[model samples]
Target chain A: MAEIVLEGITKRYPDGALAVQDFNLTIADGEFVILVGPSGCGKSTTLNMIAGLEDITEGTLRIDGQVVNDRAPKDRDIAMVFQSYALYPHMNVRDNMGFALRLAKADKAVINAKVEEAARILDLTQHLDRKPANLSGGQRQRVAMGRAIVRDPKAFLMDEPLSNLDAKLRVQMRTQIAALQRRLGTTTVYVTHDQVEAMTLGDRVVVMRGGVVQQVGTPQELYDEPVNLFVAGFIGSPGMNFLAATLEQGSLRTSLGDLPLEDRVRRRLEGRDVPRDLIVGIRPEDFEDAALVDERHTGHTCSATVDVRESVGSDVYVHFTEEGGPAGTAELAELAADSGRADTGMQGHRIVARLSPATRAAEGSPLDLWLDASRIHVFDPATGINLTHPER
Target chain B: MMSHRNRTLTGWGVVNVLVVLYALFPVWWIVALSFKDPSTLSDGNFVPRKWTWENYHGIFQTSEFTRALINSIGIAVIATTIAVVLGTMAAYAVARLRFPGKRLLIGMSLLIAMFPPISLVSPLFNIERVLGIFDTWVGLIIPYMTFSLPLAIYTLSAFFREIPWDLEKAAKVDGATPWQAFRLVIAPLAAPGVFTTGILVFIFCWNDFLFAISLTSTTAARTVPAAIAFFTGSSQFQQPTGSIAAAAVVITVPIVIFVLLFQRRIVAGLTAGAVKG
Candidate 1:
């Protein structure tokens, strides 16, 4: 029920390592904002600063319009759910959920009532008397959530709380968490490295990289018009495909074939001191099997030998290697390294297209594919900045 | 013919029996001697040739033995309580804080733990005399605390480090002050380690003879181990073997009871932090 504002928040360690730099955000009241990035990208550090677990090197954190930079965590009235769950091992579920109220010396009956209500909300009423050790991973996670919920705090800070659960339980809890947050309407700041969680859970996602804020927008906005190559590559599951291209006569000559720029894209590229060598970003779903594409809607088409074809019920993903090299840029290289795919040693550019399952694309067979030219994003290879979506 | 597994099991059973006998024979002999009549004290029989309760009755009848029993219990209990409380705080600091000379502090405590207590007994005796606590409970308790604090710290710090640091952070965010977080959350979790260390400290203080006999000149602080040496028989030429055995049995009872009461906790405390659950 509170709005949290971070004004130029920065975290500098004693060894002079900057963990987070000038992080700025103003989460609206009751908004669920996610800080998403790869490991060591300072998302968790920023969250700790917000929670008052880490010292803020230079910034003012304001909660509900009051500056709380010097306040302790308890004084700030925010509850945190740690990645490890951090349930009091010695206390049973009832006591764990009632800890905060008991610490505040609340009436026994009130503590019991609130704890029972929270347990019921988390579907943990049956486990009220059990210790955290006896509970399954998902149940322990629910208790951690229940611990936060029973307090009725001003805000909630979750640091990869679901990361320890199995995949199925994680999704189940993620949905539960979303429903619970909507019902409670508490300001929540969740930090996670999983982009899908950020995309699904947050009203607005703040993407960070190397201790700096990359972009802050809605998930759809980031997916449709990413501020840079990193956000574009980090947002999607299969990730956006980047193909190296050379600008020639207002047409981009890529390995997929020469694609004529649409009028709107050409206008964006005009008079901008654009680079000749560019990177074209295309979402996987933007490409379709040419045989399935309607003839009435013409677009850029190319043929490539499919290296792998994976069908996942709804769509068939076909991966092909282009003759041109990877979209080589410092940003793309760092992204590849972050994803643990840099040392893969596969030559040429690998592109993945999500086509209809009805398509007959097969491994090692040449398949014609149609690209939605208007959906493609043109980037300056030297800067990793999207040329078409220059305005964030 | 025995199967291989059966033979191995038999071999282990024999070894275990031997270990049990080797460990308990002396204790049984002491009990047997305590019950033997004064005249049958040195008979070759393992069990007493004739048993009587006179030795136990004799030891309890003396004010000197009773006073020493009270002194032993009081000094060990006080020393254990103080050492465990101080050690828990120091160990928590060592495990969690980042002050300078942390490594030096740990190393120095370890050096003290390994130092020979006999070497310091004389120096400590002189120091205690000068300080006017030479023959008092305070004198005996000080040395015991000094010797046992390091052990307490080492054992408790291992347990403290095994506790997740996130719990403290969670407690803080749960509306607990630093002190409240420790008392309500951390201390309860460290109960096993504290109990284990307390029993060990108590046992060390209870059985100590070198410092106890050397420092105290009278019954003021003469613990049972030291008092047993000064026991006398009814006659001038008689040896007080039964009385000494009775006192030894009396002092050993507390330690045995302590171990038996907390045997499971001691084992758990020793191996608890070795792996994450």
Candidate 2:
């Protein structure tokens, strides 16, 4: 119902540590925007600043085109669903949902009717009279949502609302939240560290790292054209594989093999100061079993010893080790540390390739893999910037 | 052979009986003393040989005992109410706020709680007299509040810490003002702790004999415990044991009633549903 505009919003703590710096984002009316990053990336702090729970040390916050830097959370007309649910323990589900209306001094009948409608929408009608202690985790989550829905506020701010639920329930509730937002058409700003939630639930996703935004684009755009090494490694499952490579003449000299650059990449690198030492990025799905590849499609091919083969019903993922060392850079090291794989002392550069189910690749066996050279991304070792997609 | 579980049960049963006997024996003696006739008061029997309501009747007939009882109730009630209100605010600030002297405030309260009351009795006596509040309800109530405020703050702050901080933010986001959030959301959730603290403060104020006797000399502000020491018989040569026992029983009834009324609420885990485990 309203567009939330955060213009250079910054949050600097009293200890002089900057939690968020110059954050700027204009959430369009009825658009679902997700702020996603690893832990300590200031995603929640940014959301809190918008909710007025945290003071913005710099810049102005505008809601519906009015500056509300000093307005309280209640005066801002925004509803938030916390990660902990935070349902009032003393009140029953009905009263918890109708609290805002009651606080506004609405008529009793109107409060009851609106609460009933929200309960119906959330499928919590049977639990309206039950205390929060009596309901299941999913039911409590619904009550949290119903509390926000009954207000029909200017926007909804959700901070990892599904994190408390189990994995299966999280997926189920994620779909429900997406559908609910679409049906209500209410502007929502969701903050989460789970990139999958960011990919699936948002019209546009903002990938952040170290309190700075890396990229903001649609899910497909982010997946296909990540602007930096962090976003490329963070966006997709099984993450993009980073390999140490060197660019010389018109090809990339990698540990797997020398890969001839595609015409488009060669054209993009025509007049730029291309670094000799580069980090080559390739998504797992971009690799194929050479035997299953189309005959007419010409692509780079490499032979690797398959260390592990996993069959997940529809496709097979083959993990292997290359002779080259890991593509070590500050950004990739941070990404590895964030994923808890930093000190693993991995033997060699690990590579994962998604292959067709029909391919007969076995563990400890040699297999020929085809790489889609045109989909490959090259990053500068010094700056972590995706050299091929720098304009994105 | 007896089963191990049966033996354990029997052992616990014996221990429970012994504990109950150890706790209730003195209370039984007091009740028996209150019911004894003045002529048989010195018999020292566990049970009263000739039971009578004479001691109760005698104490009630005198306005001195009745006035002292009224004063005890009023002072304890007022002190507990004021102390709890102030303590709840201070505890909330201690639990939630980040101020400069927060640690110092907590330390000071703890220090006051541990301070010996007898050492301050003479100083308080002089201060109260100079302030023109000596021998009055305000004098006793002030000391009672000052001592019990630390107990209230410590107990209530522990309870406040158990409550999730997100609830307050949720309340604000739900369109409640700061005062409304504390009143409606935080206070209700903190009721068990508040009630428990109130009971403790009341009992502390009720049973305090040192201050009660040292601060007040006349019937105007004398509480039951203080007045009990001044009780006399019909003759100066006779002792007032039966009357004193009766007054003690009368004062003990309110404490028992308070515990019985709030026992369930004090034990209830009210924060169960506030957040996920």
Candidate 1's TM-score reads 0.97
Strongest candidate by DockQ: 2
- Quality of model 1 by C-alpha lDDT: 0.90
Fraction of native A-B contacts kept, per candidate = 0.57, 0.88
DockQ of each: 0.50, 0.89
> Distance (Å) between predicted and true CA of B253, model 1?
0.9
Sliding window of 10 residues with minimal summed lDDT for model 1 chain A: A293-302
For model 2, residues A285-373, the per-residue Cα lDDT tens digits are 98999988885255699899999999997999999998888899888888988887778877777899998899899999999999989
What is residue A384's positional error in candidate 2, in angstroms?
0.2
Model 2: docking quality category: high
Off by over 4 Å in 2: A343-346, A390-392, B1-9
Q: How close to the true structure is residue A355 of candidate 2, measured as C-alpha lDDT?
A: 88
Worst 10 residues of 2 chain A by lDDT: A290-299
Screening candidate 2 with a backbone cut-off below 3 angstroms (N, C-alpha, C), the clashing residue pairs are none
Off by over 4 Å in 1: A295-298, A343-348, A390-392, B268-277
* Residue-level lDDT tens digits of model 1 in B1-277: 4698899999999999999999999999999999999889988679888889999999999898999999999999999999999999999999999999999999999999999998898899889989999999999888899999999999999989878898899999998999999998888878888998899899999989998899999998999998999999989999998999988988888898999999887566332221124
